[model samples]
Target: MDTQTLIYIFVGGTFALYIGIALWSRAASTKEFYVAGGGVHPVVNGMATAADWMSAASFISMAGLIAFSGYDASVYLMGWTGGYVLLALLLAPYLRKFGQFTVPDFIGTRYYSKTARVVAVICLIFISFTYIAGQMRGVGIVFSRFLDVDITLGVIIGMGIVFIYAVLGGMKGITYTQVAQYCVLIFAYMVPAFFLSFMITGTPIPQIGLGSQVNDGSGMFVLQRLDAVLTDLGFQAYTSGSKSMIDVFCITLALMVGTAGLPHVIVRFFTVPKASDARKSAGWALVFIALLYTTAPAVGAFAMLNFVDDVNETQYSEVDDWFTKWEGYGLTAFQDKNGDGVMQYRPGDAFEGAPDYSGETGPSGERALANTPNPESENEVYVDKDIMVLANPEIANLPPWVIALMAAGGLAAALSTAAGLLLVISSSVSHDLLKSTFAPGISPKQELLAARLAATAAIIVAGYLGIYPPGWVAQVVAFAFGLAAASLFPAIFMGIFSKSMNKEGAIAGMVSGLVFTFVYIAYFKLVAPAANSADNWLLGISPEGIGVIGMVINFAIAIAVSRFTASPPVEIRRLVDSIRVPRGAGDAQGH
Candidate 1:
C-alpha cells in the first residue's frame, strides 16, 4: 500500500481501538473513573503504567537525543528506567495500600493540612502541564511529517482525539488505550532498528549490533568506528562521556528520582487490586518499559551511524533526496555556505553562499578552501532531535508501511501520555482543590462533573502551549522531571518513610524545594543577560541537574523542622503503618 493509505489505515485502526475500549470500559462511577474500580490485574496495570510513564519523550525523542549527544546522554536511559526500580521497591506497594485516588490526597490526609494539599496540587498541575505541553508538541511534529499537515492543525487533531477518550473514560479509559499504545509504539520503534542493525552489522538484535564489528573492513566495533568518525568530524566520541562529570551524575540522579516521584505514574499503582499486586504490577511495568529502554541504545547507535553514512562525504549536489524532501516538510535544511558545488560539512560561519576558493592561504595557513573554517563555530547544522525518530524508518530505507506505522506509533505515544497527565490534573483539581478545600459538601456526581471540567480546561491550556512550545520538547519535558524530583519526590518519600515528619516540615520542605528549583531553572534557561545569569548558576550546575540539590534541601528542612515541631498525630501514624502491610483492602478515602 502507499504510505498515505497505510497511515490512514493504521491511524484509523488505532482510533477505532481506543474508542472501542472507551465504550466497553466506560466508567460508571467516581471510583471507576478515578481508579478503574481498583481491580485492574497487576500485569495489565503494569503495562498500562509503563505506557503512561514512557510518554512521547521516551518513544519519539529519547533515542534521538542519545544518538546525537553520544554517551553523555546515557543519563536519560538510566535515569528514566532506573526510577521504576525505586518506585517498585520504595513507593508503589505502600501508596497502593494507602488507597488514595491522587497524590494530593495522601499529602492532605497524612499531613492533616489543607494548605499542604493545595500546594501539592499546585506543584502537580505545574509539572503535569509542562510535561504534557511537550507531548502535544511531539504529536504535532509527528503528524505534520507523516500526514502532511500543518503542526498547529496536527495539535488540534491530537487534542480532539484525546478529548474524546480522556474526557469520557478518565483513568478507566486511559488504561487500556495506553496498553495498546505501548504495543504499537514499541513495535514501530523496534522494527526499523532491527532492520538497520541487520543491514549494518549482519545482526538482527540492535543491542548486539551496537557492539558487533562493522563491515567497513575495519576490525573495530560499530561504537569504536562511530567514535572515531565523530571525532574526525569535530564531534565528541560516540561511546564516551562529554558533559561534566558532576552534571552527568546529578542529572541522572534527578531523572531517576523524578520518575519515581511523578504523581501521574504513581497513581497508576492505586488502580490495581492488592498492595502485593501493586508490587507485582510495578515489576511488570518495568518489564514493559524495558522493551523500549533496552532497545534505545541500539536505536541511537544505529541512527547515528545511518545519519553519518547518509550525509558524510557526499557532495552538496549529491545530497540524498530525503534532504530536499524533508525540507518541504520544514525539517531538513541545506544552505550552501560557499559557491563551490561541493558542500563542506566542516565548522564554518561563512554561510551566506558559496565562498570563493582562493589560491592564497587563509588563517589556517593552508590552501583557501571553499568554506571559511571557523574552528569554534557552533552552528554547523541545526536538525532538531525530534526529527530523528520519525526520520529513522525512512533514513534506513524501510518500507512505506513501516514509516506509516511509525507515524501512528508516535501519535499513540503522545496521546496516551496526554490522557494520563490530563487524568492526574483533573483528579487533583476536582478531588483535592474542590472537594477537599472549596466544596467540601459537594455530591459525588457534582465532583465527577468538576473533574471533567478541569480535564477539559487542562486540555485547552495544553493545546495552546503545544502550539507555542517554549523550547526543545524533550528538554522541556526533562525540566518537568527535575521539578518533580525537587518538589514532590522528597515530600512524598519523607511522608511515607519518616515516622516523625510533621505537617510543618513537609510543607516547608515542599515550598523551599519548589522555589529553589524554579529559580534555578528560570535563571539558567530563561534569563537573557547571559553573562550575569551564567555567573549566578551554582557551581555551573545546570537547572536540569540542580534537582539533586533541591531534594537534599527538602530532606534537611523536613528532618530539621520535624525535630523542632510536634510529630504527626497518632491517627496519621496508624495510617502510615497500615499502608506498609499487604492484607489491607479497605478504602482510605480520596481527597
Candidate 2:
C-alpha cells in the first residue's frame, strides 16, 4: 500500500480504539469524571500518567530539537527524569493520602483559605493551558506533514477526537485511553530507534548504539564521529555541550521541581487507591517515560548523521526523493548561492539561485577548483530542525509502514496530554471554582454537566491556540514548568514536611514565589526578551533557569514568614501529624 493510505489506516484505527474506550468507560459521577473514582490499578495509572506527562514536546519535538542542538539537550532528559523522583519522594504519596479531587483542593484545605484555593486554580489554569498549546501544536505539526493538510486542519481533527473522548468519560475515559496511547506511542517511538540503530551501528539498543563505533568502519564512537561532523560544519560538538554550566544546572533543577509540582502530573496520583500505590506508581511512570527518554539521544544522533551524509555538498538535482519531497513542503529550501549546479551546505547571504560566480569571492571566499570546503557562507539548502524526526523515516528509507506508525504515535502523544490537561481544566472549573466555591449547593448531576461543558470549551480554546500557536509555545510551556517549581512545589512540600507552617506563611510564600517567577519569565522570555541575554540576567541565569532562584525565594519567604507568624490551627496541625504518620494512612478519606 502507498504511504498515504497506510497513515490513514493506522491513524484511523487508533482513533477508533480510543473512541471505543471512551464509550465503554463513561463516567457517571464527579468522582469518576475527575479522578476515575480513585480506584485505578497502580501500574495502569502509571502508564496513563506517563502518556499524560510526555506531551507533544517529548514525542515529536524534543528528539528533533536534540538532533540539531546536540548535547545541550541532555538538560531535558536529566531534568524531566529527575522530577519524577521528586514526585515519588516528596509530593505524590502525601497528596494521594490527602485524597482530594484536584491540586487546588489540597492547597485550599491545607491553607484554610478560599483565596489560596483560587490562587492555586489560577496557577493550574495558566500552567495547563500553556502546556496544552504545545501539545496541540505538536498535533498540528504531525498531521500537517503526514496527511498533507494545513496545520489548522490538523489541530481541528485532533481537537475533534479529544472533544469526543475527554468530554464523554472525563478522567475515566482519559485514563484508559492513555493506557492504549502509551502502548502505541512507545512502540512507534522504539521501532524507529531500533531500525535506525542497527542500520548504522549494528546495535539494537539506542543507548549502546550512541557509544558504539559506526558501521562505516570508523573506529571513533558514534558521538565522537557526530561531534567531528558538527564541528567540521562550524556547529558545536554533539557530545560536549555549548551552553554555560550554570544555565544548564538551573534549567535542570527547575525542570525537576517543575515536574514534581505540575498539577496534571500530581493529580494522576489521585486516581490511585492508596498513598503507597501513588509512590509505587510514580516509579512505574518513570519506567514508562524512560523508555522514550533513553532512546531519544540515539535517535537524534543517527537522524543527524543520516541527514548530513545524504545532502551535504551534493548536487541539488541529485538529492534523494525525501529531500525533493520535503523541499516541496517548504521545510527544505535550496539556494544555489555560488551556482555551479551542485549543492553547498554551509552557513552565507547568497541563496541557491543560479547566481553569478565570475567576480564573486563567495559568501566566505572564492570557490575552489579543489575539494569542497565547508563554507562559512549561508547554506544553500536550509532544513527546518522541527522536521527532523518526522522526516527521519523517509530520510533513512525505512519501510512505509513505519512512517505511518510515526503519524499514529505523534497523535497518540499529543491527544493523551491534551485530554489530561482538559481534565485538569475541567476539574478546576467545575469542582474548585463552581461547585466548591461559587455554587456549593449545586447537584452532582449539575456539576457533571458543568465539567463536560468546561472541557468542551477548554478543548476549543486549546484547538485555537494550536492553530494560531501565539509564537511562544516552547517558552510558554517551559515557563509553566518554572512557575510550577517556583510557585507551587515548595508550598506543597512544606505542607507535608513542616508541622508548624501556618496558612499565612504558605499563602505568602506561594503568592510571592508565583509573582517572582512569572514576572521574570515574562520580562526575559516574553516582555523585553532582547534583555534576555546572560549579562542582563541576575547571576547570569537564563530565562529558562530563573525558576531555580524563584524556588529558593519561595522557600526563604515561606520560612521567614512562618517564623514570625502564629502556628497552624490545632486541627490543621493534627492533620499534618496524621499525614506524617504512615500507619493506617492507606485510604485516608478518599475525597
Give the per-residue lDDT of model 1 (tens digit) for 1-591: 687899989988998898888878887778887999999999899889988988888887788878877787788888888888998999888888888899999899889999899999999998999889878877877787778788899999999889888888888989988888888888888888888889889999988888899877788898898888888887667877756777778888998888888998999988998788999998898889888899888888888888777866567577766565666654455544444555444433332222211111222221112233343443333344557778888888789888888888888889989999999999999989989898999999999998889999999999988887654333345467777888889888987887778899999999898888877776655553243232465776667788988888888888888889998999988787776644524454321
Stretches of candidate 1 off by over 4 Å are: 347-380, 471-475, 528-536, 581-591
TM-score of each: 0.92, 0.92
TM-score of 1: 0.92
lDDT per residue for candidate 2 within 1-591, as digits (tens), equals 999999999999999999999999999989999999999999999999999988877887678768877778888889888998888888889899888999999988887888888988998999999988878877887887788898789989999999988999899999999999999999999998999999999998998998899988878888889888878976667777767889999999999998889998899999999999998898899899999998988988999999889988788888888777766655566666576867766543234321121112222221111124235566676665666777888989999999999889989998999999999999999999998798999999999999999999999999988777554554565678889998889888888888887777878888898899888888876677557677898887877778899899988898999999888889998888777778755668552
Top of the candidates by lDDT: 2
Candidate 1 colliding pairs, count = 5
Give residue 72's lDDT in candidate 1 (0 to 100).
75
RMSD per candidate (Å) reads 6.5, 6.2
Clash list (residue pairs), candidate 1: 337-353, 338-354, 338-355, 339-354, 339-355
Model 2 lDDT, full chain set: 0.84
Model 2 residue 130 lDDT score? 92
